[model samples]
Target: MQINQLTRVYRYDGIDLPIPPHLADDPQGLRAYHATLYPAILNAETVDAGVIGTTHVTEYRRAVGTKG
Candidate 1:
């Protein structure tokens, strides 16, 4: 199947958060929705982890940059 047809999964805190049908293809909207569930996500970075078993895995990685 094409990448677009694959199910998108957001991995956060060792939990998988599947994207809602309504928020499909809306990256910004999905971020906003996810932030509601995980406030820390507001500052997190979206990292694409590639496909795995028919699922497009993505990770919300916490930003850790030292202010220099």
Candidate 2:
């Protein structure tokens, strides 16, 4: 899987975090990455609040010839 695009920012627990362009393609990898930072983000009081964002993914496939 490949990530075609990512939102400018992601809002989690009332905080806005800048989305890294080179995020992992797997869902679990992405979640684990966020989980590592959620603690500080949730505990911080100086972070600003913002709306949630989303990520876009794209998959490429090639057509194969088959016998008639």
Candidate 3:
């Protein structure tokens, strides 16, 4: 999603993260409720065809008392 859109959504969720316009224009930008060690992954079958890119995986640390 675009940064403006993300900002709007975050506002609804009570989050106020400030994102720059340049990063929003980048092809590989994302926001998540959980902190990430890596980035997001996009599959060709899931996205528009003819687009080549790298998939970054995010690993969130489970909260205390949570069982994996």
lDDT of predicted model 3: 0.29
Worst 10 residues of 3 by lDDT: 5-14
Tens digits of per-residue lDDT, candidate 2, 29-68, equal 5444565777543332332233335533221112336647
List the global CA lDDT of all models. 0.88, 0.43, 0.29
Q: Which ten residues in a row have the lowest lDDT in candidate 1?
A: 1-10
Models sorted by lDDT, best on top: 1, 2, 3
Task: Give all TM-scores, in the order shown.
Answer: 0.80, 0.34, 0.25
Candidate 2 weakest ten by summed lDDT: 55-64
Q: Residue 30: error of model 3 in Å? A: 3.8
Q: RMSD, each candidate, Å?
A: 2.9, 16.9, 12.4
Tens digit of per-residue lDDT, candidate 3, span 1-68: 64321121112122333445665544345343212322222211112222123322222222335446
Give the number of the best model, judged by TM-score: 1
Candidate 3 RMSD computed on C-alpha atoms after optimal superposition onto the true structure: 12.4
Model 1 misplacement above 4 A: 1-5, 65-68
What candidate 2 gets wrong by more than 4 Å, as runs, is 1-8, 24-27, 39-68
| Clashes per candidate, residues 3 or more apart or on different chains | 0, 0, 1
Enumerate residue pairs that collide in model 1: none
